[model samples]
Target: MKIPTAAGFVTLMLFCLVHAEICPLSCICKPLGEMKGWLVDCSSKGLKEVPALSVSTRKLYLQNNSMTTVRAGAFDNLRNLEEVNVSDNPWNCDCDILYLKLWLEDFSESSIANVICATPASNERKPLSQLSGNELDSCRKSLPIKCLDFFWRDLALITFAVLVLILTLCALRKHLRKIVLCV
Candidate 1:
């Protein structure tokens, strides 16, 4: 049997450990289970967006970062996400953030209650779950007006159908009376 050289063995070990350190951009990737949450810290890395994380992340702390925007559907795939701390970032209050805010509102179990904004407008840390209808309206003001127009069109179609049904019933009743008089 041939014996492997020491250099060859070291190279194999390094290859196995490479995946644990290959984080995207300014973030660091580490096995959270291996370090007890101490090695997976992603806060204040000057991240402009939320980075993709492994499925094992149970708690994510993103406070005091330079994140300026969160794209729509950013966290759509994170089904296992239990907690998220996104306070103290320069969040742009705009329509793109509306989807995230709406989703956060629908999912009562989400923990995005402390996300603060620092640009375009400064306000206290706002709870995503508490965003009201007026806030949604303000965000949606710049969106295409076709969405509302379509809603009205649908309503008109339903009303027309109901009116047609009522008119048909009236004509049927009048015809039945004429037949009874002729008999």
Candidate 2:
């Protein structure tokens, strides 16, 4: 096969460059493979928010940032994302971050370990991947007051039923006494 001429090679390179996805200005991007897409690195950038990523981003690195919360569906656009690193970030593991916790559980061990929770003392230092979806759901649902209300409602109903039963028994007893006296 004949080697490509300089002009032909330059044209090919230009074509590839034009078709390649551009990484966010705040992060560095490395092309992984034809099907894998770009690996975006936003580590140590002091980012309080996640940068807009290209749909072609396959892997993302956001370690050691100051992100307190990541909104739901933040990664919905990056459907091909395979790996992510946010281990050193001081994550506030509150209701707002519950989605991230649930999302982490869908990955493998290596990917899961890359994210560690920093806040909500109960979950501190825990791998985000290990957090169960149900647990996160519980965190998202502020059900304590509702549960207490149900408890009180049931208690009142039971107390009312018990009082009615006691009153019925007393009335029946008085009726039986009157019948025995008449007999």
Model 1 earns a TM-score of 0.58
Model 1 pairs whose backbones collide: none
* Residue-level lDDT tens digits of model 1 in 105-183: 5554444566654444433345445555445435556655787899999999999999999999999999999999999
Residue 21, model 2: lDDT of 45
Largest lDDT belongs to which candidate?
2
lDDT of 2 at 2: 100
- Which regions in candidate 2 have their CA more than 4 angstroms from the true location? 1-21, 129-141, 144-183
Clashes per candidate, residues 3 or more apart or on different chains:
0, 0
lDDT of 2 by residue, 95-132 (tens): 77776766666655675577777777877887666676
TM-score of each: 0.58, 0.60
Q: What's the distance in Å from true for residue 11, model 2?
A: 10
